[model samples]
Target: MLSVVIPLYNEARTIVRVLEAVQEAPLPTGIGREVVVVDDGSADGSADVVAAYAASNPALGVRLLRHAHNQGKGAALHTGIAAASGDYIVVQDADLEYDPTDYAKLLQPVLKANADVVYGSRFIGGEPHRILFFWHSIGNKLLTFLSNAFNDLNLTDMETGAKLFRRELLQGLMLREKRFGFEPEVTAKMARIPGVRVYEVGVSYYGRTYAEGKKINWRDGLWALWCIVRYGLFS
Candidate 1:
């Protein structure tokens, strides 16, 4: 089974749609999926929405966990990961930017090459991508480059939200980031694991604008750079 860990905040406007997509996404034969949604104290009734959805779809294996107050995304993920009982795990954002259909694509390396980790790259695919911020694109590439320089990795999308991991490998890590820094911190630590087989695949990106509820910004990019140095070089 694959556990989809969704670290949700105040995304009440899109959480239900994301849940439906997860429910309907087609997985490879014999691979069952369960959703672990960790609501990080959403003020917009996102937790209530998730509760209602899980109550309505009793057969979907949707498990809802809650934080009493707003912790960051990484903190929420820590909670979700601990509660996951699947053989493999994948992180899913509670937004429309990422399509759940690509879960199949992310699983290919695991089935064929015994990949311990898989990263879905948005920059290398022929799949449809909404043309958006040029600076953000550059920032992603620059961060990837810096991360590669520090960790000796060749990943094209270190900051990508779509990542898959063997449950044991993921739960073994000492992940400390509590916000947007999760991306760089995880990438660095995962790279340091001796003989770990990591893979990357092209995936579609339907990025959103700030008006469409996009939360990341340049400050987060700066923090990611610090994370790369801290985890990649220091720890």
Candidate 2:
């Protein structure tokens, strides 16, 4: 089975849509689905929406966990990951930036190519992407480059949200970062695993604007850079 770990903050506007998309998403035959949603103390009723949806779709394997106060995305992810029971795990952001339809495509490497980890790269492919935020794009590339230099892995999008991994592999790692720093921290640690087969596949992106509810900012970019140096160079 594939465990979809969705870590959400205040995303009430798009929570239901994303969850429905996940439910409608197709997976390869023989691979079952279990959704683990962690609500990081959303003030916008995101948790309630999830509860209503889960109650309505009783047959769906949906588990909703909540944090009394807002923690970072990584913390929420930690909660969901600890509760996951699938053979493999994938991170899904609650926002509409990533498409749930790409789950199967990202899982292809693990399911067929013997990959222990797979990253969906938004920088590649001919798929449609919302053309916005040039500086953000540069920030992503610079972070990816720095991470690749330290970890020695040629990944196109280290900041990507869609990362799939073996359940044991992820649960075993000592992930400490609690916010946007999770990206670089995980990438650095995962690179150190012996004989770990990591693959990257091109995936579509529908990035949101700040006015449209985007939360990541320049501060997170700086945090990611620090994470790269701290985890990558030291460990």
Compared with the true structure, all predictions reach lDDT values of 0.93, 0.93
Clashing residue pairs in candidate 2 are none
Q: Candidate 1 residues 1-235, lDDT tens each?
A: 9999999988999999999999899999999999999999999999999999999989997999999998799999999989989989999999878899999999999999999999999988687888999999899999999999999999999999999999998899999999999999989988989999999999998998999989888988999999999998876
Q: List candidate 1 segments past 4 Å from native.
A: none
TM-score of every candidate: 0.98, 0.98
- What is candidate 1's local distance difference test score? 0.93
- For model 2, how does the per-residue alpha-carbon lDDT over 1-235 read when each residue is reduced to its tens digit? 9999999899998988998999899999998999999999999999999999999998996899999999899999999989999999999899978898999898898878789999999988877788998899999999999999999999999999999999999999999999999999999999999999999988899998889899899999999999999999887
Residue 7: error of model 1 in Å? 0.8
Against the correct fold, how does model 1 do in TM-score?
0.98
* Candidate 1 clash pair list: none
For model 1, give the 10-residue run with minimal summed lDDT.
121-130
